[model samples]
Target: MKANETIIVEEQLSAPISVVWDAITNLNSMKKWFFNNIPSFKSEVGFKTQFNVKSEERNFLHLWEIIEVVPSKKIVYNWKYAEYSGNSLVYFELFENINNTTKIKLTCKITESFSDDIPEFKTESCRGGWNYFIKQNLKNYLENS
Candidate 1:
């Protein structure tokens, strides 16, 4: 079995904590950037949401189970794909800074056994992708909207 490794990404947003929280918890707001309009998410704890993700040559039907949710503060989920043998945890934390801005932290950990055969194992792609999605796309959307 492969031991899990966690990746954390943090960003300081110019938007207020409430505004940033709304952007993440509100389905419509999330659709604009996070899931590219294909995610129907329920922010309630224990609810499961499905998302359709597509790249240049492949499409994925991803399922996420909400594990923890605290309004305007934290959210956590379990993530897995149909073809993958491993499971992952995704966490989101929001902190209110002294400047009235929000500091968003996202962390993910993969728990599946990974070998050299799995291309995603030990690849920087996953972290890079999340960085783009959260720091660039989501951040821009929340700040601008």
Candidate 2:
């Protein structure tokens, strides 16, 4: 992906903002729907974690560092891959609406160019991945959990 390219996916979930916040910030909840191999996670700024995700025939060594947090409102982090040349900033914002529905907005901006040879690094691939995680995976998880 090119530097500064951004992809966003927003979903209104049938859960409270607190629940959504927990789903994103809590390690157990995250493992349920996000990444199962996340060894450890903390919402505190500067906290860092690394894990490997195998997709198709490639292994991506995922790296992340928490950059900011606002309790149940927002969380920001820097995401990258140890084997790739790129940097991305991810922002998750939550809003509580009527009837306990919560709006979850996820924005991923490529702060630095990613290796273009990988199919998963394409813009559409990234967009589809985010949509699956937010609108489908997380949404189904929050509604059914």
Whole-model Cα lDDT of every candidate shown, in order: 0.79, 0.95
- Cα deviation of 55 in candidate 2 (Å)? 1.8
How does each model score on TM-score?
0.88, 0.98
* Candidate 2: residue 109 Cα off by (Å): 0.7
Off by over 4 Å in 2: none
lDDT of 1 by residue, 29-119 (tens): 8878787654477788888877666655545568789899999999998887665566788898999998889999999887765454554
Provide the global lDDT of candidate 1 against the true structure.
0.79
Residue 7 miss distance in model 2 (angstroms):
0.5
Steric clash pairs (candidate 1): none
* Model 2 TM: 0.98
In lDDT terms, how accurate is model 2? 0.95
Clashes by residue pair, model 2 = none
